[model samples]
Target: MPHDAKAAKAGTRPGGRSARVRTDVVTATLAELTEKGYDQLTVEAICHRAGVHKATVYRRWGGVDGLIADALALSADQPWPIPDTGNVDEDIQLLAREVYTTFTDPDLRTTPTALIGAALRSDLGAAALSAFFTARHQQAAEVVTRAVERGQLPADVDPVELVRAATAPLYHRLFITGEPLDERAAHRAAAAALLAARAGLFDAPAP
Candidate 1:
């Protein structure tokens, strides 16, 4: 999960009973996603783990899809992964490494891949995946923003697309190609994205 500080500062961060309940539900939701996957996940099971009544969850969340969506938002609310170290190359490298680390972490490794699979199957899943990526793109775009401010990138660059281009190849290797990811692979992805950005490939189209 990638979270921006700006949003957290705006009061979306939960607290008190709401926080407690959200923590429990979200934790349970991830556990279920990691184990049972989207298709097999059930509200009853999540409630059992969260220790909240099923009706309580249903009334607020509507069902499993709502829980899944909020669970993603909860995770995205964490401190963003992209480092703002003032060097575009280094920042993209850091971003790649962070993506690699997340996809390889035992606790989180399965969830994204599973969600990708889910995204291919249902509208709920597509929406959740979209929201997740939207949050991540927002967070990642920061690195590019820093780069542009420092003149490392053209002012016309699309920050979000730049970040996405950097990470997409890494994800392809991790999830689609089943290839091993290492420092070399990570740097390669970053460099390719940098090259593309330098070529104005990531620039926004003229209005």
Candidate 2:
């Protein structure tokens, strides 16, 4: 692929040729990151995979870390369809299934784990990880908040906490215990979190 110099030089949020280049870079980075662990991921490797010159990768992303951050941001930006099934139980199941699907996706699953591992080992990585999670949490919170407003949930639930509860177990299994991300485990965790929320674990204190 021919590298467009003007596109490479343009601002981060690009249009036209710049946007196409950005998309290509991100796609290439994701492929490299998935195939090779973080330690082995290189600018040269991304450039080779992306069919762009090393200078193009360097000019756009600066380095491997910058590239990974952009890839992660792109992954995070991918739509997470949240269902509002009118019944909280059903909605929670749908959310859990969605998460399970994501965790099992060959391409996506490794990216987050790699990013989180990097975050644990480096301050800069940690900041990037924090930003990623903050965006994810905010999105999840909005879904839960909408559920609460619609009376699909209790009146006083803290959507942020509820979202965390739903996801924490899966993270724990994936990161803490290094267990498999299987369907049974996902369903159990989702059910537990929804049950707890229904039981008022995330409810606001009465005045």
Question: Clash totals for all models, in order?
Answer: 1, 0
Q: Write the per-residue lDDT of candidate 1 for residues 106-138, one digit (tens) a residue.
A: 776687666566554667656877778788988
What lDDT, from 0 to 1, does candidate 2 have? 0.74
Consecutive 10-residue window with the lowest summed lDDT within model 1: 1-10
Candidate 2 lDDT by residue in tens digits, 1-207: 335665455543456666677788878876776678778878888888777889877887788887767766765687666676676667666677777777778866676666666555555556666777777777767778888888888888878777777777787877678888888887887788888888998886777
TM per candidate comes to: 0.80, 0.79
Best by lDDT: 1
Whose TM-score is greatest here?
A: 1
| Every candidate's lDDT | 0.80, 0.74
